[model samples]
Target: MAVVNKNQLLDFLENRVEGHLQEAIRVFQNERAEILLQPAPDGGWSIAQCLEHLNGYGKFYLPQINKGLNQANRSSNSEIFKGSWLGTYFTRMMEPTTGTKKYKAFKNHIPAPDLDAPAVVAEFIHQQEELIVYLKQARQENVDAIKIPLSISKWVKLKLGDVFQFLIAHNERHLLQAKRNLKNLEVADKS
Candidate 1:
């Protein structure tokens, strides 16, 4: 992973969180349930499923990130963030524009087809708000020194900065997919 000024990275992540929040509020919130529940033309997950999938991840990661942030010691000096090789790999894999590869979600994270669209959108909005708070708190701590355990395995931990990068990238990927679903729905409706 590339080394970067900690503050710059956090700011970037915070911007992404804000974008996600706005997307939820401005786009998803106003969408009707039928549209949110409609799958893509290629039979992919619906918009509600996409948000619910992210919500599932937030359920596991938010508390862990908060715990890590609370336990982290304050840094008296500015620091640089350098991600581990595994962390870099994960973050890159999750990036929306990286590749066309389709990764399967863990069974637990796979959302049900019949989700309540309004509730899922509301939860996603709330999670993005919480992420903004975490990003702010992270500025006071040594992001490189704190480690957050992966949801996949407790033995595997990532630097706090890496966790933020990976989680935000994952969110971006799914949010892009959800937007694609919306576009497809619109095209179908016009036809």
Candidate 2:
């Protein structure tokens, strides 16, 4: 098990989690439904779709995380968090890197093109807030020992720490995609 500074990890996750929250709010304030629903010039997912997809993931993971946190054995806070090798590997795989490979969403996670833009955005914002709560709860739990089953396959499980890392990275990846989609829409409008 690889050890990490628990305080540092918490701070990192908190900063990124709040960033997503603020980003979602900014998107809600600045973009209208038409702009959010506009598809990429090349027929990729629209900004609304990107967020809806994330919401789908959140719908599955958030509850499981909450349940895990609730059931986790009460223990004194550790100064360091020990990460499982498999979980760490999965998190690293999902994280965004320069020239990262694109992954297709599983069928159930795909959002319909006609999804309500405002609702999708609002759901994402709500989910991020819920995730922030879990991050705080995690400070008191043995995150490395609590296992969360994967939504994609029930048999596959990951440590809570890895789950947080993976989900946050995944959200950031799509948020960046949504921003790019909006930028492309702007360029098209000006053309």
* Predicted model with the maximum TM-score: 1
Residue-wise C-alpha lDDT for candidate 1, range 1-191, written one tens digit per residue: 78999999999999999999999899999899999998878989999999999999899899999999887777543568888899989998999778459998898898999999999999999999999999999998888888899999999999889999999999999999999999888988899
TM-score (C-alpha) between model 1 and the true structure: 0.96
lDDT of each: 0.92, 0.87
Name the regions of candidate 2 deviating beyond 4 angstroms: none
Candidate 2: lDDT over CA atoms?
0.87
Worst 10 residues of 2 by lDDT: 90-99
* Each prediction's RMSD to truth: 1.1, 1.5
lDDT of 1: 0.92
> What tens digits encode model 2's per-residue C-alpha lDDT throughout 35-60?
99998888999999999999999999
